[model samples]
Target chain A: MTTRRGTEERIPLLLGVLASLAIALVAIPLVGLLVRVPWSNLGSLLTSDVVLDALRLSLISSIAAAALSTVLGVPLAWLLARRRFRGRRVVRAAVTLPMVLPPVVGGAALLFALGRRGVVGEPLDAITGIVLPFSLAGVIVANTFVAMPFLVLTVEGALTNSDRGVEAAAASLGASPLRVFWKVTLPAIAPSLRAGMVLAWARALGEFGATVTFAGNLQGRTQTLPLAVFVSLENDRNAALAMSLVMVAVSFAVLLGLRDRWWNNR
Target chain B: MCTAQRIVRRTGAVGVVLGVLSALVGCGTDSDSDTLIVFAASSLVDAFAEIGAAFEEQNAGADVMITTGGSSALRAQIIDGAPAAVFASANASTMDAVVEAGDTAAQPEVFARNRLEVVAPAGNAGGVSGLSDLARSDLFVGLCAAGVPCGDLSRDVLGEAGVTPSVDTDEPDARALLSKIVDGELDVGLVYATDAASAVDDVVAFATGVDMTTPYLIAPLDGAADPELAAAFVDFVTGPVGRAVLSDKGFAAP
Candidate 1:
């Protein structure tokens, strides 16, 4: 009985040690970044045209990507959750494939699908004279390709777990299907919707491989913060670290603000 | 609740064991004294592979491990304390960066030089004949991004020619630019002469009279585990056998 009591007493302490180790794994690198930040030269570095241009491009492309992902992913998620049909499993697998595919491979796939000489893109370019590769639109497409999986998976999980009885009740009470969906289902999954959007936005913002591969890296054009960090790392380590810190701060702010708004409203 | 607590306790023990094992692996290297780790630029991938094989054949009981990437990326790895005995960078500036960082145990020596050439699709599908044609608004041109050694050389040559091309993309490296040109996605791009030589079937090269060139530099790093082996490898690179390999690979003598 005494030995059992001693083991019980030690368990919490052991768990505490493991938890701290996990925390340290994350914290040490962050601390290293903070320690090496060139505080004195930060003003100049942040003011440089390269940094400012990349910041603006990152914001524009990531926001555009998140919006596109939500527009396309939500309906797809609903289909995956509410409907059963032939090839459903394949469709579902395809949607989440980007999550596992290396971003470079994803970029290559995008090129094969939408490049100037691609099947659809060739005809489109011939008719419209619009090329997608090496353009800002290419950045958005690449970002959306890689980021949509996050939003889709999140909303699908939320929809699958929620009670569908409310939707049926609304439908039986003389409400149209669209109206019932908006009034009952949409509100029910608002928190997850918001969370998914934030996660997708963060992923898009940090996207590097696909963006560089598809859109190309041109300052004030397609170069996002992540790409800028890669380029800056070639010449200036301090500038690269500063750019990374900027991304970290922005992502943190967005996620924190989302949590606060959702929790406060609830 | 008691069962849940027991599960958590088991998970905690597992996590502790995993952490300790990883820490042990992180500090321990199995090949203690026989391995020579060389960090090289991506452009040197083919040349260094051949050189490493030759070096291993000549030196008994010593193996050469080569890691290749963009010069800057390799330098960053070295700065972050990657276990490398020698570093062969594509440009002097990259080697200079290491020297400034005090990473070099010996003075770096230039082994080879590379010059830029204009590359386009086979049969000159773009009808681009010279460097000035790059400035044509209708043609799509790709150049290496600023800060990349090849890009820096491109900018220098373009400036000397007094022409600014309509560059639709700034690729991160010469190989990427070459691919786009070969794919006909880019009408033209400035790439190393060696790159042009290797991809002759895919891309046709034009002499642009651009004199800008970059030098390849090699040095033994201060943190090398086997300094003598590193020095020997450096000698092999600068030796006659190394020169023959580089020449065959299209590099100019330094």
Candidate 2:
């Protein structure tokens, strides 16, 4: 009994040590960010027109991308999670191709698919004379392409883990499939959906490679916060730090707001 | 009871001490002698790789590490205190920023010059003959962003022509613009002559009326761990062998 009790006591101590080490690894870089951030230029950096424009574009495009991803991704998630069709496993893997592929490659792929001379783009250009590159819309498209995977993966996980019996009961009660999804499955997955939205938004906000590749970094049009950070780092170190601080603060707020349900329960 | 509690506390303290000691050792092992870091512009990738290898061969018991990126990004990394012995930029402007920050050991030197060329997809379907053809409404044009050296030069040429191009895209680098042209996405793009040479099979050049050439610059950073070696590499790049390599790659001699 004493030996068993000693082993049990050692488990908590082991967990404590592991937890502290993990915390230190994550905290060190965050602490470095805070320590090295230029506090002196904080005021002027925040008010810079270019920085403001980039911030505004980042927020607008990220939100737009997340919204588009949610609209399109939710249905895809449903198909993958609720329905078991032919090649379902293959389709699920293909949906996550963007997450694993390099963002720059994804952007290049976007250009091949949607550029002026792209397969569909060529006909679109011939008919409408509209070009997608180096425009605000292009930024949205690139962000959506890279960020949709996050939403789909998260919501799919939530759907898979959910109690499917309730969904079936609702369907058997003369409720249509759409009604069952809206009234039962969606509410059950509300917390997961919120978490997925935040993840998608953050991913879209920090998107640099794909945005620069497909959209082209034209200031005030396609230059989001991350692109601005890259440009600022080239010329002004202080401004870069300040811009990074803003990104950190925004991300912190978002994660904190979602932590209670998304993290604690999980 | 008190004796047993004391023994447990002692073991816990020893574990904590060992953990702290290991962490300190891990943090302190980042020594300069491990390697010499060089930050260089993307344009100098081939030449610097060769020079870096030669430097390592000549200096026994020393390793050379090179980081290649956009000139602007490299300058930013140096300014942000990246541990680099040498810095080479695609243009004087980026090198000047490092000098202004008091990070340079000496004045930067122009090693080579690169001129702008109008590059189009192989077998130019648009029949683009010169710079003036870029202004045609029917042709799609891609140019580098104004922040990049090639883009700035391209703007100079366009200004001289008194032509306003219907630019469809402005990429961050000459390489990206060149890729768009090579993919047949654009009818023409402004790129470095060397880049056009590298992509000969995929792209061909048209004449530009204006001479908007850019010079490559190199400097050793202040307080570099291996200042002498860094300076020697810069000297070699500005010497005969480097000139030959640059010229062979279609770059103009400085």
Candidate 3:
């Protein structure tokens, strides 16, 4: 036993070198970004009119997207978790497809399906004067399309692993299914639900390709932080760096704060 | 799952996603000295394609990989250490950035020039006729962001015409703006005449009578792996063969 522990403690030199390389591959760019950040002008850059407008739009759209995800995702999660249906695997795959699909492709899909001249958009616009693209609603839709899958998948996994006997007990004790859900099932998966919402929110806040493609980028209308960072990289690298740092900070805070508490389904 | 196991699993999942994505994009390739990389602006896509083919034909055992994107974006990439032998930019400003960053071997020479045109979707959904129609607030007018040469020219032409454009979206490049117009998502947009020519079936281009033009510049990068090959590529772009191809693609001699 002692000999086994000794050998286990000594990682091979080659492995150590390889691991360091792997970390360096990821850390070098981040370190470089930090080293080159326009620190003296960061505050002013972040508070500039362009940056401020993008920040405001990003927050409003991402928060609205998160709320929409929770409202819509929780139900979809429950449906997948509790219901037994044919082609369930296909449905599940379709719902979580965004998790793996390139955000740009997802954006293109959304554009083809919902753009002003899109299949449904044309008819809808003709009927009710509701144009989805280039509007705030379009931004929210783009965010929600890319963000909701995180929430749905997280909540669904939790629901699948949850103690179902308790929900059955509530239902059997004269409570209707809706009452049992609101009073029992929801409270039970609250931790995972919160985790999912935060993940989705962070994902939405950082959304770029999908938002720019589907919603289109306008200064005060559709430009989010990621879009701002992208466009700024051309003319104003410092502003891009500043906006990137903000996203990195926010995402880091969200992941670090959530890591210990809820990520393990704790 | 335990935290350690979850972390490892998440990492594995991310690795798989990245692997698939990278594979979809193309294989990770080592830099090959024989392969000359040329970064060109979006408006030069068609012209550069023919030029790349002709350059490859002239120089045996040489592979020319031409990548097209917004000149500003390509300039940013080059400045950020992209390993390209040559850069062909849509505007002098973007090429100036590369020169200012000490990426260029010499001053970029203007090889070609392009003018802006007002374009609408194939159906002309918003009934846009001329540059003046871009000011109609009811129509969804799209324009390239000022970061790109086309956008700068568009904005200047509009200002010169005394038209207050009611722009709905500012696409990052002429290509994006053109694509949105062709997709019928945007009613009208300003793009390079070359781009408008490339998609005649999907969009209708109108002469704006603005007389504004952006000059295209090409330069070999400093410290290129194959300096001779890079210089040759730049010369080929500025030479008679390049001019013939550029003219066929609707570019005027600078």
Candidate 4:
């Protein structure tokens, strides 16, 4: 057999060098973080009640937000992907608006809409005697507000691009529309759903501005790891560095672990 | 074309691009620029603006540039090599952080004093008059979170009053707490007297029973690019003109 030598592609040196620069832009900060890890203080800082509390809050809130996003986002994605109706374009824009809205602004909006004296919130408060602000529920709501957009947009894109032939065939075979969606379309786009969920969970975990703005920064109640990092960053650099390392390590591991399970399968 | 020659040419082009990008980044901030940089706390926003403008008019060829934020944040920046000539903090301890970092040329001098006051929305709908009123669990109260000077002072005042009020939120700064009060989301908020005085239209301030005064401290950072100008700026802040501005803004005499 003859080797196909002439068919080998030649990569340009300029592109290769410039691509390395882009990689360095991402890598240098991570390298700097690793270098300034405060290794001696890391164990104590991690074991501290403050760190544990924030870690617990961040995990619970993020997981809750991701689950909430899926429960609400899937139907919205389906509507955008499949339906044609009045103000459909407007609906799509509104659905994805949170993606572009500043998280702080989102927090303020949430405050007004659901705050104690707010339009819905006032009535809700009077009837149920439940207040949302400065609580774990507030953090979860803020996270869901910001993170749900990511899942919605991702799942919508996947749904739009996915083959509709399978669903149509199932319907022709006398399967109900709900059955078709549950068995045929959903299974076909399972990879995208998983990807959207992971993206949303990560976004929720990193949420700081919205959470701090809406939920307030009360330790073990509303303060997540990001808030803890910001508070510690000013007074205690070592503690801040340790907390940041934990966040970075957790996020890195999550993305890495998810890549093989969801990404490569597609 | 020969592969080696092509490679050399590509490397030369990439080097030129990288150099241009870095040069662009470096060009924005020039240390030699004749502007005098002052880092002040957020509470000093109104007073410092006037002081900065007055200082500029008094000194020929000296433009005062002020950067204001949470005092603790500004101090952290100074430690991280922010080229601030003067540091005026909302509290003494925040300024001490810079002094202890070997960034200050002299001990921080108290230039003004601020007191914490409970601010209620217009009409005092919740009838929150004093610290005792804040203890009412039904009243939504906002206070600055601890570690911030205003927050620290608030905690002290609340502790002194012996009322562990059910706080709805702990804001990062006094301004945020004040805004919450103005928005009517919070029935009452503990903020600096200066903050309430500044927003008189939106909120009403009531003097706290606790006798606590938060001292505003100023220091000239060491190794200032223009040490003479930094020293002069510090003098202007503590001198008659600065005191007048601070007083007008509801700050007490140091």
Candidate 5:
């Protein structure tokens, strides 16, 4: 990957201009949000009852989604990466479909599959009297449906590129299959695992369309921070801005936490 | 041609197309000739849609584009300069927001009236024989989120009926709530009489025993692209033809 001398100086003006415009596209709206933020009472607004409830729910659902995604996505990702099975490619495509689908569509798909009158939802309800929609459980389900793809994709890439020699050696040294996975393979992909978890958690925290569509927007029950901001945008602009500030700050912190893994040059 | 020249030509073509697209977006149905953009409350969807087509037929070469949402949200957009040629609000205060902001060409006139009605699936009824079902915790109840005209009105109707609902989802708009009701998602829900009537095939409406007296308002916007045409459209909505269409769709005369 050696570069010739003065190659950076050859950068074209068109690309430089477009690159700056791209940066502005991402940065301007954020700066506008900062400008309109109600600075005087932001601390108080952030600590208000509604805000606190939303934050608590967001943390609970997002963390739960991330954890569930890891437990489920890792195995799926591994099978996709390592197994030579029929329909493996189909499974991988299905797993990643959520990443590209509009989250509202994903939520509607969830409703069709898991709603009260849904395919599985009908039998599940008839048997257990449990309805997934319009519940806190629904919020977690929606988040996991949309966020799991990130974890699965990242972990699968890591697994595919990971060294298998160590696990084979550990197996030859009398380690059981489970011990090889835990001791040799798990630690090897730990970096990617951590990165994947954080990415999935951040996606879950910011999830809006699916959660709102599936869980419904009830303050203190199903209203995550994003939904709270949306409901408030009509009547309370200051509150929406305050909540958005919290989201932006948290997202920045998550990105900073992953800097060591992704921003190796820094 | 050189590869660099080809890239430049492609970029230029893209730039021109983007420029044209943005110009069209900037106009946003604000032109004086063909398009008439109307922002109406969600409950007025079926009624206004009919009125729009009739108006279009009379005013040949004029297209009517209607955007429907919660009245409060619609007013917020109008006040923020969405360039809507006409606005039809479900409540007076929602229309007042635009009037107070000086975005209306004139005072909004009361054109129709609607009230809340409870509804459940037409068949396979969910024990929703009366308003009492809205209070049942076992059944899923849906309503428009607070701050929208329908949400505010729904709360009023519920309060007058003295039934405290176990609301499951506060939909962003009344139409979204209505669609879900028709989908058999909700056991019972409160929606505009007009909405319930439009969806009579799917839902069975019940009287909440509360009279709904809210008056619907419509007006021409201040910066309408075609001021004369906008005023004409407003007149058409408040006129005899509009009245007939509104009543046919289950709206009461204001």
Candidate 6:
């Protein structure tokens, strides 16, 4: 009896030590970023014209992609979560395809679909005389393609876990389907949507392969912060480390701000 | 609640064991031996791979690992303390960067030269005949970004022609630009002669002058694990065997 009690007491301590070690492993890279950061040159690196251009482009494209994903993905998530239909399982699998596919492969697929001579892209080009490849719009499209899955998966989980009784009650009270969704379903899932949006934005911000592949890496145009960090590392190590530190700080701040509301709401 | 607590406890214990194993694996290091790691530019992939195999055959039990990427990227990796025995860049500038950091064992030697060619889609979609036709308004041109060697050479040729073709895309590497041309996304692109040769089925090259020639340079990095083996590999690359491989790949001997 005493041995059993002692073993039980020791299990929690063992778990605590394991958790600490795991946290330390995860923290090591972040600590390395902090330690290697050039503090004195940080000012100049941040103020550099190329860094500013890349940061601005990253912000603009990430936000645009996140907004577009939310707009298109929320409805799709709703359909996947609430509606029971044929091929629903297949649709669910397809929606999560981008999440599993390699980013470079996803970029290649995007090129095949929307490139200048692509089936639809050719007609669009002929009609509008506009090309999507190697443009800011291409960055947004690539980000949205890769990021929409996060929004869909998160919101679908929220929808599945929610109390559908409230939705049904609203429906019986003569509220239209759209009205019920906007008033009841949306409010209940707002926390999940916010969390998903943050995740999507973070993913889009760190995007390198797709953006570089689809949009091309032109400074002040297609180059995002990650691309800039990569390109800067080619010639300037200090500038690369500085840019990495900045990105780490921004992502940490965003995640921290959303933590209390979206993460702890459940 | 008790049953749930028991299940959670079991999961926590398993997670702890797995985490400890992973940490141990992460800390494990490889045993030292007579191995030479060569990081070369992607353009030299075929030639270096052949040379690496030959070096291994020549020296029994001496291993050679080759990591290939864009010249700038490979150089950056070396700067970041990658355990590279030898560095071969597609251009002199990248080699110079490594030498400026005092990382080179000796001065880099130019072993081979490659020139840019205008590659068009399989059927010649844009009627691209030569370098001059690239500037036609109807042609959608894909060029490497200015930072890469191929792009720098393309810029030189284009400047000499006094024509600024409306570049539809600027890929980060010659391979990506070549892929775009092969995919029929771009009517024409500037790529290395070897790359054009590799994609002969999908792309046809247009002749260009000597102005677009890009020199390939190789330098042994200082503090290599196996400096003797590194020097031997370098010697092989600048010798007849390497020249034969490069020539077969359409690269001219410097």
TM-score, one value per model: 0.90, 0.82, 0.90, 0.90, 0.91, 0.86
Clashing pairs for model 4 are none
lDDT of 4 by residue, B134-217 (tens): 788878878887889998998889898898878877787787788778878789989999999989999988889888999999
Q: lDDT tens digits, residues B1-254, model 1?
A: 11111111111123334323433453224443256667887778778888888987788656566666678777777777666789998898878988899999999999999888988888786898888988987888899888888888899999999998888888888887888788777889899999899898998898879777799999999987678889999999999999999999999999
What's the CA error at residue A143 for candidate 2, in Å?
1.4
Stretches > 4 Å off in candidate 1: A1-11, A260-266, B1-33
lDDT of 2 by residue, A1-266 (tens): 23555566665878899999999999999999899887876898889998899999999999999999999999999999988799999988988998999999999999888987788777887899777877799899999999999999999999988898998898888999999999999999998999888899999999988888888776687889898887666556677789899999999998887866765333
Report the C-alpha lDDT of model 4 over A170-257, residue by residue, as the tens digit: 9999999999999998898898899899999999999988888778787888989999988887667788899999989999998987
- Candidate 1, B148: how far from true, in Å? 1.3
lDDT of each residue in A1-266, candidate 1, tens digit only: 23555556665878899999999999899899888889888889888998999999999999999999999999999999999999999999999999999898998778777887677777888999888888899999999999999999988988898899999999999899889878999899999889889889999999998888778888888889999998888878889989988988898788878866433322
Worst 10 residues of 4 chain A by lDDT: A1-10
The segments of candidate 5 whose C-alpha lies over 4 angstroms from its true place after superposition are A1-5, A9-11, A263-266, B1-32
Candidate 3 structure lDDT: 0.85
Number of the top-ranking candidate, with DockQ as the measure: 3
Worst 10 residues of 6 chain B by lDDT: B1-10
Better of 2 and 3 by TM-score: 3
Task: List per-candidate RMSD values in Å.
Answer: 8.1, 10.0, 7.3, 8.1, 6.3, 8.7
Off by over 4 Å in 2: A1-18, A35-44, A127-130, A264-266, B1-37, B50-65, B125-129, B132-140, B155-168, B221-228
Candidate 6 wrongly placed segments (more than 4 Å): A1-13, A127-130, B1-34, B132-138, B210-212
Model 4: runs farther than 4 Å from truth? A1-11, A260-266, B1-33
- TM-score attained by model 3: 0.90
TM-score of chain B of each: 0.86, 0.82, 0.86, 0.87, 0.85, 0.85
lDDT of 2: 0.79
Better of 1 and 5 by DockQ: 5
